[model samples]
Target: MRAAAAEHGLTLDDERDLTPYLDLRRPRDRFIAALVGAGRPLPLRGEYWRMLRGGDALQWCLLNGLLNYRVLYFRPAAG
Candidate 1:
């Protein structure tokens, strides 16, 4: 895995950084992945950013957690 990432100019300096990749093998991640796949009904990427921009106070904590998780773990594909 590290070799593949390095080939793509990505560095895995910490094992914890692989949590998202590992989590992505689970059912929930599969569902999310499929939902965000090309031509899927959900525009998950846009929705996430939009929600972060104007989400209500009721969802503040959840949104904040999502933001933190995304920042700390999510790694978009390279090229």
Candidate 2:
């Protein structure tokens, strides 16, 4: 992930530089803080966290479905 970000000229110095501005006590809090610091509007209450979690779940399901389909339909035949 870090390599990919770096490839796009993006830096991930959260551990040292942005840690002071972030609340590292909780994952959700840190994520929200980073978004706000980057000038992004935050969602009300826990909505941001919920939405992120839901998106992750959906992505996982899609990737799993694709992998299963590939295995079933595109596998190489054994001699």
Candidate 3:
């Protein structure tokens, strides 16, 4: 991902420094990958930003539903 971002003149170093704005879950990475695939800028809170930036209220609701599910059922348990 870093290499790909660099090819486009975007420095992934920003990501490292912005980690505190992220959700600290693997699914957040998936969401960022989705946004990158869509040719959008990386959001400040990653998936949370994506949902907030949805084209309509319905899309926002749907993405939030999915994110809720991931948080409830898929996020790894803390060790």
Best to worst by lDDT, what's the order? 2, 3, 1
Ordering by TM-score: 2, 1, 3
How much does candidate 2 score in TM-score?
A: 0.27
Give a tens-digit lDDT track for model 1, residues 1-79: 6667667677654444332442223565444444444334545457774443343322344434453232232344465
Give the C-alpha miss distance for residue 74 in model 3, angstroms: 40
Candidates in order, TM-scores: namely 0.25, 0.27, 0.19
Give per-residue lDDT, candidate 3, residue 51.
63
1-79 per-residue lDDT for model 3 (tens digits):
5556556555532222332343432565556546645655544556765564453343344446533222111222233
**lDDT (0-100) at residue 42 of candidate 1?**
47
Q: All candidates' lDDT scores?
A: 0.44, 0.46, 0.45
Highest lDDT against the true fold, candidate:
2
Cα lDDT over the full model 2: 0.46
Tens digits of lDDT, candidate 2, 1-79: 5666556565654433322342233666456545554543545357766665555454445545532222111222233
- Candidate 3 has a TM-score of 0.19
Name the top TM-score candidate: 2
